[model samples]
Target: MTAVEEKLQLPRIYKQTVKMALYDLCIVGAGMMGSAAARHASEKSGVKVCLIGPQEPKIREIVSGNEVFGTHYDEGRIMRATATSPLWADLAKRSEERYRELENLSGVQFYHEIGALTVGTRYGQFIGRTKSSLKGGPKGYDNVEILAAKELNDKFPYLTFADNDEGIMEKSRAGYINPRKMVMAQIVVAVNQGCDVIRDIVLNIEKLQGVYKLTTERGKIIWTKKVLLATNAFTGMHQLLKNPVSYKAMPQTVTLAAVSENTAKRLSQMPVVLYEGKGGESWSKTYPRDSSDNIQFYLLPPIKYPDGKYYIKIGHSDDILKGSLELTDIRKWYSGKGDEELEEELFKLLDTIFHGVRFENHHGDACATMVTPGKQPYIDLLSPTLAVALGGNGYAAKSSDEIGRIAADLILTSKWTYDIPKENFKVKFHVPSKL
Candidate 1:
């Protein structure tokens, strides 16, 4: 034992091991946008990046502990970038490519090809408008196919359609992506690529002499040469951005219910389905169940919201978010109370699809923020070292990498040029009644 122990001593150091200093860039809020931005910023600019967010913090901690619930957290259902703009199509395709590449990069499964179907009445004006307005090929929307009701029903026999109904059936070019897993994958990639992902909540930002200093809730001050504020829904992140209006920050509540696969089967065959029908609200979307076999609840996108009466959220224009609402402060939407009447509306929708499912499996609710200040997202510069790229609302997932690309380019080149054609920020709802 003595001889073996003596031979197993620590190796002598040949040279001093140097510790690197603080990063060149710091990304606040490690949700989808932040994580994705951090990865690209580091890779493109070759600058060390520091990612700050709560990762499974103790339950009482103020940051992510109350929000991000470890691997149990998720970003609901995702759609392939199907916008009628070439800029949107290119951005979406890039996001989709990265999602697929993450599997090999992180050895974690991050995408599912459940696919999507947009349904509406054949003779309905909404359907006709969708086909026509989406025509003449917006930059990124040239490859999409438009289908009539019979063809849609034939391919997806699981769904019922009226005779005069029409459909758009897309293939691998579009499908379902697991938002949470994709986020985790980006986090892992950033870590492996030599980015520092710190576990802390940023309290404030102070600029001294052109360098950015970030103060954390724990009272630690970190300095970085450049800063990218990628907080998705955290209110604090919005205020930090040079331009608040560009964030157009708003909060929306959504529901996630667990119904047996048998029930999901009878509703819609595809993973993601949207209702743009004449008078129909986006009722339901079904993704193949997660590892837990629970389908996700995407609920409302940005255009979907309560009347915005006050601090807390209320009302929904559609059935999907309405019926399956889980009551909790996942995103801190409250005045210290649960809106039972709102819960009842959500229950009505859940009851329609999942007739007898028990609420025992109803995981507590969660929330995230949307930033679509304008029709086209602006990646502009208010200062030399500071840049802002936000306002996608819930649609950020489709264009996040490009968002990061533009943000990073602006910071590195001191130029505010858009990598993707910016959608015009109309200050109007992006969708009718919201998806």
Candidate 2:
């Protein structure tokens, strides 16, 4: 054959076989933690990183009917330094410290530093733990103050609390973050640092000759030296590790009450509030009638949604939505019509809190978080070449920057350099079926 004809044949030969792309590290589930890990690993370790995950479903005026849902697929998430545990408190502080830096680097506005309040009876277990956390957890918590009921009322006039209830205010470096924007910011940084982000779902992961091969839903193969699974609730649905990690995929429901623009403007200065019943009771009970029980509910300040209306978001604690969910269950819950009972309850609660304001609209959505038995995240070496970072225990979004750093640290050096106690986040495969 002629030389030109032979070259044409060579091109055809190369096209006959597919080449699998190799990466230094492959991260599955590019949610909050995975996205941050991709940014940190690529920038710090200077290795080729590939982040694989499905894009967040678009936010619609109606919460239901979404194709996919994630905990971080919302407009705002509370970012507070106060926590029931010192470990989480420190992690929140660490994550907050990097927020401004991330925003500047990515040119995305993600954090709102208004403030945060934890309200409950002074003797409540959560309040006591939060007080202790402020006392000993992090240095930036010096501005935290315990406010009496009267003081709370005087300061936050729009909020109504029980006569004996008090509030712990993280006066500075506490607020809400645009979670969707934050993930985009992290991905932007990662991409700028030469990390490749693949918009594909990971079907399975297999180990061959000390290297991990990830099989995607699109039938593509990826070979990597290490793999990090930050799949959160979806972790239970996938067998990514040689030894499976035990976790409960607890689904959480959050409701948002859209108020008039004037109302939102009036409540603009309000801080994120963790509103509890008199003695830390669930807010599910009719308020004012049964005010002497335990309740747990968190409130975010008015933030504009895509529907051109400002909404005040409130989410119930996982204790209320208690159950492990399968992948199909989560997808169905996300895409199905929202719960009318929950929406009504949210309206009643909002009416009780914001008395005179009229709610222009009301909506609700479902998201799931993986909770380990210890109520902390599991970041450990699953196998020789695979490390898993899952189970945010519902607090992963606010502390994700630090968790990501820890995950990347574990994968790169087999150890973490953070001051967080190893026992707090170390992997413990022995988990009970009931959380």
Candidate 3:
């Protein structure tokens, strides 16, 4: 047998005890970080990893001749940048390769190589800095470039901005990941590697002498000698940290609508655009989505001008977005009623690009932004048995898999082999008075 077969046939960590099964590592939340870590750890190394999430990632539909998850529709957080730590950067590069390998191994196409652009009306815009980071360099990343307004328009005729506008361009090194499909693909890889993934919500983790007892909502018990808290966005596992990484979960809502194929074609012809509007107006959550049956997705500016650089738009709770901040669900994105002024502004936004349309505001009303007060990712050994990972507000999709891999390395080997400072991984926030 070949080395690959030999590895595959090799038995996993757990022999299945009567009271609780054992795993090399038990991960919570099967989203971007957790799923990638499980898949990468299982395939690249012999780590027997287990992932448990509230929902199972559906993969067969996207591949294997069945559209189970629907017509390749996927929209989620954007992954950008090359990575700050060498360990992370290299892992990110490998993850891109791994994404292809996953296609080769599973016969599914989950990634698009379209380069991303971050348009800034002025300096101090961190998204532009993030685009430059993905370019990869010492003076700055070589893969990234600063595009003058003229060059920007020439490269992407669909995009227009103020004459003084500056943009950060990463040539093909960055692109959006179909977040939902990406999650499914990674979990598929993990399960194929002899790892067991059960669908259940982890309610609590109790330290038992040297081991951890994990209780699930299904009443199933799982025991692991080690645990990795890979849950991001919103899962209160931060309390489990001996050195709990800190990230503020700023709930946000995005207004999504689908236009005709013509509109999509026009927008698709344009490179992914992020216009930080002039007059202090800014658009943080908008992108030309070319990968789904859901038409296009966008987050319009709250006001004609963003009085501040970045601000979270908020509103009352609803079904999917109970704590929604989306203006599309109730307020009109086109001209209408009490919000006519805001509606007209958004209509002009579309008029600048496409024609003809239908709209569906599919996602839940509430979306969450995992913000790090210091603007960085937090990776650390929270305890001897617990490891924590979060805060990818910058470009998590481009970085999470690799970050997750480093996190696994740190957890399994007991040290941060990379050169990133201790402060880079831990947050020193003031303890709350009335918790």
Candidate 4:
């Protein structure tokens, strides 16, 4: 039989496994990271890999039994190489380099290289760390332009900024990515590389003698030698991790402003903006309400959503609702509109930034971001056979490809192969306090 035919027949064999199909590596959670790791791991010769996760739900109101959700269901996510942390900068730069190659190979288009404008106070901590991260960054990353307040207004008249706010413009390899399409592209490449795609949520995982037996919500049994848990915010919901990873699943809300096609066309040249600090005297009063509520937010240019309409999406850099939500409350949280007060504030902020812009209507939605204590993803092994790649902290969507590659390398070789320190990605467990 031809190699193509052989590859096509493998899934049939896997599905017929009343004996429990065995795979070399099984990755749970087929979101951005999981899909990317599946593609990378499947590239290894003679290795059998499978990616297991549920497809996006059709209804947002109800999440059935064991049905999980992902944060990448949106149309646009910001992509920028200039970050406050050097580690995220490296990961984003590396992933940005592969955007075109992945696009060409998978025949999928997900990246839009319009540019990115980051605004902050003249000597703000965020802007300072962003500048320091560029000290020895990759080539072409140093081609950023510093713009004064007047210059910022002149360049992007559609945006409004405080007089004290300075701007850093990354003209190359920066913009927004359609995360849903990116995940689709990654899974396409993975399947083409001989990986089986299982559309089911992993209900439970029990370690067998030398392998792990994964039980799916649909009752399919999968046995794999090594498992990678890329479960992100839903990590606490799964029984896969023996010692729970130390992470907070905080609630996030985003407001989408729908605009006419003409408005979208007029603002087509608008770059993604990350604004730090107050908007103005009136705007400042409504924002930065407490220590947890920083006056920092980001917005994407008009992007077409699945509904054949265009919207300008905006959200705060951190959680709008405070505190880590209980894992049990996740499904209900997804069903309802996130914090009504924050949604109102977001619309007010949107109107303030875009002063005279016309909008048809606006609405809010809810999602969660997995935050680690150190503000970095935990990409370490839990045991000799089980590994993890959780904790996006609101920055994983853009750098997911490289993060997935690192996760694949760790599992395939059983060692840290990346240049960055493994200690930086060390996994921490949560120990509940006894009353």
Candidate 5:
């Protein structure tokens, strides 16, 4: 017999078609939230969880190509306890506690305990509201310090603060995290706990005989007792239900700049800084001239990239170019170079804040943040078997672990069980469009 024929005939069992797989819970979109849900469901809920999503690109360089990129595929994300609302702050605190346990279990170091600073005008309403929400002393925060402008400048001399600006610093459990690594670590732990991870795009979801059937791009099928749509930007892209969930995808851009080794070292001890813009001011009027304005900007600490050069990432709260985007529009934007005007603005902002720190190579990428009309995540059951955990409002990354746990709990028990108020995360149907 020929070698090929002999090999083919060697094991008839090996050539047999595999049986269809069934999962207790099937999660789509294995990004930050979905991966954590898979891990929590498999480990804590003891369910047969299967996670489905495309593999992260090996090369994330800002190149021209036809590839869909994720917002969380970055070196670092700012994790802080200072939020506009107390519920959000509590969510961040809860997720911070879980970060330690996840690191120990997965043996992956992702969270950095450096610290975080939220700076605004001394009398700004933003700062006042944040401080008020964080009341109850240490019960609400860990070693929180409200620093005056002079005090902030004294501690972080490299940063430029307006004379009237003040900062709120959380001394513990606040800093940045390697979002890409954190997602991978969650998947690692989930797989170790008997969760199946699939690298495929889900095309459609349908219900047949009271079971959720997920159809993948590769023509594979999966049946699950419950389905969780943790997909962020691509939340309503698929026809997952008879009546699709509604969400608005707000496209945003982030710029990354590679600084000199000396500058990186100088900024090594600087905490994550959020330059809270004044309520209604322009960047040109607020930044170089004064640090108080309505142009919100945030900075992540120096993190080493694949090229061995440390780059500090900066993102604006308001998009330089604003509009609602669909999944295809977001993918097309990601396939091309980022916005030049936005990149230039970010570089200028960085230079102003860091006192003329020259950035060597600057590049940027496009990502979309989903938001409901109410500006909170919608975690509710679409049907008896289909549950969705969509809408981050561009501030959900730091609290994704708890959000994911909430998603899983909603799927397993068909109810919201987290300590957070159900109204904060409850899904609102038939809401008028904010666009």
Candidate 6:
């Protein structure tokens, strides 16, 4: 191992009771996708499986150390079946169909199926493309209602939108999922199906004669017939693969504005909103291409947080700021507040959208998301004994259950069983010269 790897390595604890136990498959991440894959793999294949990943740190201070973090630590992630891509829309529709089933089976509640609204310029191609993608896609776009600015403003009086912008409201199978609770639900379901959960960070993976060896930070070793890498933003770390996969881990900031109970009640009918409109010069920079005309802001209604306060949260679309590919930089990035100027910009954006709503208090936090070349996840097998199902590209949270199901099916059956073409998710490897 290199000197940098040694500095982050955990001291090996030689367990006196150590025994080289074998598993049919071992998953290297226990986040949304990994946990869902574990549930599917164990329930469908009846194979001995192990899900390994460290639990989320109880406080933000722990991120100062060499710790792994998850973007699903938040209370809400947008859930919708309509998208610009047919594949994503299909994946989301499949996953949304199982929300009730998963909830009843695990006896956990994570989905709040209120509704979802997306507004964009009438002249832009986004609204038309989304509608077209949904016509022959999943759910047939019947539940989506197209409304002009007048009808939209009359329906959602609290929201302020430009006259030129139109809206699409998904009446069903769309809303927000509490990601933290969603992971818990998956873990519960997976555990009920006889999958072991290992709460430790994966330090290394090595291939043996017929199985792969997994080394945890605390020195626990597991042998499995196959391995699935769902490590997301941390995939390049730990040198699990011979060649690193091509992906970007971009820094993001979300601002949460606390609202009073009365204000929350007034906005109770608010649907998860995605608005594409103009951008300000200070925060919006043309990166990779001209994005000034394509700036998007996603908003989640007032949801109660762990602090017992109700707050509305908002985040900017990707490619607005530069990001890093270094493990050390990504780790350090999570230790502090994200772009302060961006946070202020979000505050103003929320005020402008919400009209007369007054926020009690607001704060910004740091997060990172993984993006792939095609903006779709890579659910492919690296080798006969090793597979990978990662790279959410920001759209995987709502579609995670379906993605996991596809991955589990691939790894267990060694077949591309999904209706979508396998070529759409082929993994590509390219190490970037600079972050």
Worst 10 residues of 2 by lDDT: 8-17
Candidate 5 lDDT for residue 293: 27
Candidates' RMSD to native: 10.9, 8.2, 10.8, 4.4, 6.8, 6.8
The candidate that wins on lDDT is: 4
Ranking by TM-score: 4, 6, 5, 2, 1, 3
Candidate 3 residue spans exceeding 4 A from truth: 1-20, 44-46, 56-76, 82-97, 122-146, 237-245, 277-365, 427-435
Per-residue error for 158 in candidate 2, Å, reads 1.2
Better of 2 and 5 by lDDT: 2
Worst 10 residues of 6 by lDDT: 7-16
Model 6 TM: 0.90
Candidate 2, residues 238-356: lDDT per residue as tens digits? 55554457777776777888888999999889999986555322233563222344667889989998668899987776655435677668777666435557657766777677645
Across 313-352, the per-residue lDDT of candidate 3 in tens digits comes to 1121111222322322221211112232333334444444
Candidate 5 residue lDDT tens string, 13-99: 112232477788899988888988898899865578888887766654446342445668777888888777787777788889889
Clashing pairs in 4: none
Off by over 4 Å in 4: 1-20, 63-66, 136-142, 281-284, 290-294, 431-435
Q: Against the hidden true structure, what lDDT does model 1 obtain?
A: 0.51
- Candidate 1, which segments miss by more than 4 Å at Cα? 1-22, 44-46, 56-72, 84-87, 123-145, 235-238, 241-243, 246-249, 261-269, 279-331, 334-368, 417-435
The Cα local distance difference test for each model comes to 0.51, 0.76, 0.51, 0.83, 0.75, 0.81
Clashing pairs in 5: 277-293, 278-293, 278-294
Prediction-by-prediction clash tally: 22, 6, 16, 0, 3, 0
Q: What lDDT tens digits, residue by residue, belong to model 6 across residues 104-215?
A: 8777788998899988888677777777777654245578888888898899988877777888899888899999878877877787787878878888888778778788
- After superposition, the stretches of candidate 2 with alpha carbons farther than 4 Å from their true spots are 1-20, 59-68, 136-141, 279-292, 430-435
